[model samples]
Target: MSDQKDILKNLKTSSIDRRLSIAKASFLAGTRWATSNATSFFSSEKDKEKKRKQVLREQARYLVSEIGKLKGSIVKIGQMMALYGEHFLPREVTEELNTLNNQTIALDWDSIYPHLKNELGSKILDLEIDPNPIGTASLAQVHRAKRKSDNLDIVLKIQYPGVANAIDSDMNLFKQMLKLTHLLPQTREFDQWFEEVREMMHREVDYHLEAQTTQRFAHYLKDDSRYVVPTVIDDYCSSQVLCMTFESGISVNSPDVLTLSQERRNLIGEAALEIAVNELFVWGEMQTDPNFGNYLVRLAEKSDEQDQIVLLDFGAIRQFDKDLLSVAHDLILAGYDHDLDKMVLAMRGYSFFEQIPANIKPDMAKVFLIATEPFSSLKNNPDIPEGIMDEEDRYDWKLSHLHNRVMQRASKSMASRYFSIPPKEFMFISRKFIGAYTFMTVIDAKTNLRNMITRLN
Candidate 1:
């Protein structure tokens, strides 16, 4: 349990309370910014620019701090913007917003228990519920529970009361706050991304949709021994509470995982990457939030048993359109072939790529080639660092430094106005891959990516 001061007794769910909180914060931030600007008028140009950036950072910090105190959908909105708003939000603002923690102070059981009882009614008696949450996020908290009838271990995801009802008002309030701070660009792209965030917020709170998604993924992966998805307990589920079997495992970055054998680690990494690939090529839907907490590694107790990955949290699943998936597929295939022309041609299917100048296309292609280096044959991709690929063609993910190289290439190629925010769909795909890459890197896993990509092909 958190200190009483740290635990939230209740979220300020009323529209008036939320609006007033945001309005005060925005007004304060905006006033500070205007005052700073006015004061900098007499300074030298260099000092003025320096002071302006400093003031912007201060204002952003103040706004985020205020948002943090709200402890609900608005904070989530800020965090989502931080992840996807790089193209539209000012650097200072996004940098500050990124500091908003996903794991906020848990609502006290006194507050959450009543909501749970109301949602589950007499059915709540079927389980022994833990008052302390095992996990707490902006939208909900999860508690470990056990069915009294058979002592089956399970978990209950309890949504914060009124969070779903407050999404629209909170989103609008956040936008107004951003506008007041003058930190967001008023562009069509910003509006589109904002709506995307709004839709995602709504989806995150929809227990029915999440329940179906969890079941769908569980069904799809039923035959795959390498993964585990929790089975939803329908009798205990409601609009505010989702109940599922509690799959137990250690964290993906746990010391136990780090101590695993090389082959074991490689298998784990391969399974992780294969899921991301399968989501794009086969499933057409993805669990887009790649936060490390979303995954847990269940080690095998028997020598003959394979280790399994416990995939948790199906709230952020994204379904891609067929056309977008086709283009993305082509891009990866083109990268595998190391064909610049093919890569450039694949880029044309997306509007974001069309914005890239002709001369920059080859540079962007090179970045894609670097990104897919592990998926390519040594003969096709000459840029792979020497010794990073073993004789068996397994790519050393830890030694490859792949993300840094791709980022360097992108920075060099897309400098200035030529840089564009990718289509939101692409952003989700890329973020998923990045998450997979980070997982592999953390585990120091080496596997034959060529084989994995070939299987997908």
Candidate 2:
């Protein structure tokens, strides 16, 4: 009875007042840092600017540390700010926050034990759980365990006591902070983007829902020998706890992976590309967060020399509506042909541009085409300029300057009356694509990504 009361009390603590306190602390720290830095003397104009940048960097680090200590949806928000919000934030802020990506600070087991007992009851005594967690995530920490019944080794994901309650409190405070700091455009469209994020956060905290999502994805990929997904152990799962078979492997970008032969790396890369295309085009769903921590590589059971991929954490699965999927297909097709008019029509239908300037529409279309460059082939469009794709079909990510071109085009679009947020669904899906593309670029993995698209159909 006391444990139940404690759980309720803990959730109450993650209220709006607490969230506001965190936000207030951050704002106060920022103000102090800026004031002190600005008042300090410097030898020259260049030195002053350099010192100011250093101050900003230190402030950014402080913000990351505080959020890490807070440990809940706010940590997840810090992560998104590091990745997608980079455009809206100071470069120093985003660069410093990037260090927190997939970095989790776990709660001590004594602090976590009450919730585990509440959820699992006497069954807790029948299981052998490690005192320390194997890994920690924004909402939960994963510990290795063994079922006493079948002697089965499994992984248990235990949510922080108040996270579900904290979602709304954290997000509301985050929204207010963004408005206060001018990190997001103060518009109805941007508000909708946040509403979707709020919904996603709520879903992510529902462990039962995550279990179902993981099961569905396992079924979806079961036949594919190239990938592995752990089976959910249903009897032990609850809204705040999840149990699954244990699977281990090397991190996707571990030094050992880099030591593999070029041919082996190419196979892994091609497999990754295939997964992305099939998920978006064929499955009509995706695991939106593609952090490298969510992936692993293991030696193939049948062939020691070959490697297989293991996928983890299905909390961010998103399903596409038919209309959205159709728009995506049209945009991709138009982009391949470099058909400006068709591309514009497709994008407009998707609410990408409420009112783009007539003069800049062609440039917008070109930018969209450049985005598809990473997934395109000269075989499909032989007339595509040489630098974008080579005879060997390798997409030259660096040579194309994809990120710079997209941002420049977006800045131009923002200057025009065309400014409107596409629905949150589109933004999240695009994020998945970008995450996959960036991972491929990091490993310098080459694949005729176009060919993988055909396999989707």
Candidate 3:
């Protein structure tokens, strides 16, 4: 068996190199397409508009097909770019890359059975499982199962069989393409982003790492009955198989949240924010993916409006850099207090940029004010008198317009834009904040947001 693994390792290495070579070739083809399209459009070449569009269409087809042919880190990066949408790439490219996220083929039992047997030994059939998968994502999927000993029902997350090798090959290709196309940020300090992502994705493919991350997160929030994270099943866990006690909660995506008591919905929103703020400002650890699927509202054991929030998935956790996080805390506080200079100094310091033009400095403060949703709703009007937050009236046009302007400027800025990708540790923290606020807005729960802001002080 050891000899067979060694042989497979050799083949895996060779296959990876071949995959990288193909990826580089694909990137080159993309570059050619972009160059031709640009030249045709810019130089007034024959059938310029039509040919340029056609060139892009062809590039889209090739990239979509080629990216799907690979998996692991490269495809994952492509999907992130797609999700980022118009912020990072053209709509066409984003649309093409989005398909790569869930397109990888699942492993059949022929391949997975060996590992199942290895995990549970010859007693596999004694345990219960639905051979069909319950949920499938990029690197893993869950199966509904019951234990033989006590009939303990649980969710078993099986890591895809070959994703580790695939991720290694694909990310190397992604790194190569980043260097070639300069699609990644141009800063030297954050050059380690890809390497860090590689390390994380490697950890992600290993069930032990995910298990440990989940355990630590659970422990952190253990005292708070208001929130929940899945518990790890150490006895049943393996390098590729993770089993956790099952959870049954529904996501809050439906408009029917309107029917949910406004007070109850507000509690959900407030709890999420409390968790997010505490995590980012105090604890430093956060689960960053902002997918709505990460959250579920479970009705309380004894009551209706009194329910617990269920958190699922922890693969993409990021820790905050202490200095950066501290600056963020100070900046948000300063912005709320309406101290322009203080906010400006904090913003520039928080930005890690020493100098900015005098003209843009004031706009910067205004920008930050508008970006902080709750405070921006006050709109710098001291005489308007603060009012209680209304759950249904939570959406702020000011915040949305402000974000749109900021995103537009960021999308256009080739220079300062790269400086803004927060250290990866802060990704989940930001996501948590965004998700919490959005949820709150949906519920229209009025709170003394100022009181919440002052807690940082």
Q: Rank the candidates by TM-score, best first.
A: 1, 2, 3
Q: What TM-score does structure 1 among the candidates reach?
A: 0.95
Per-residue lDDT, model 1, residue 247, is: 91
Look at candidate 3 and give me any clashing residue pairs: 288-428, 319-425, 389-446, 390-444, 391-443, 391-444, 391-445, 392-444
Error of 2 at 114 (Å): 2.5
After superposing candidate 2 on the true structure, give the runs of residues whose Cα lies further than 4 Å from its correct spot: 1-24, 30-59, 176-185, 301-306, 338-342, 382-401, 408-423, 455-457
Off by over 4 Å in 3: 1-58, 69-73, 83-91, 102-105, 120-126, 175-192, 255-258, 300-305, 348-351, 355-360, 375-402, 405-432, 435-448
Q: Candidate 1, residues 1-457: lDDT per residue as tens digits?
A: 6578868988899999999999999998889888988988899999998997898899889888888888889888988888778778778888998888644689999998999999999999989998988898888899999999999999999999998999999999999988898886878888999999999999999999999999999999999999999999999999989999999999999999999999999999989988888988999999988888889999999999999999998999999989888888888888788888989898886777777788878878877888888787777777678999887878898898888887777777753344467678878887888888889999999988787667657
Superposed Cα deviation of residue 284, candidate 3 (Å): 0.5
Tens-digit lDDT track of model 3 for 406-450: 456544444344325544444444446555656665555444455
Q: Give the better candidate number (1 or 2) by TM-score.
A: 1
Model 2 lDDT per residue over 1-457, tens place: 1233222123224576566666776686657665756677655888887877777777677766766666678777777667665435678888877887745556767778888999998888889999778887777888899989888999999988877877887887766655544344666665666676778888888888899988988998899888989999998898899999999898877888877776677678888877777787888988888789889988655555468889888988888987788778777877665567877787665545545665677766766776776666776565455676668887755456566667676667633334233456766777887877776666666666766655433
For residue 358, model 1's alpha carbon misses the true position, in angstroms, by 4.5
Candidate 3 C-alpha RMSD relative to the actual structure: 6.2
Q: Which is superior by lDDT, 2 or 3?
A: 2
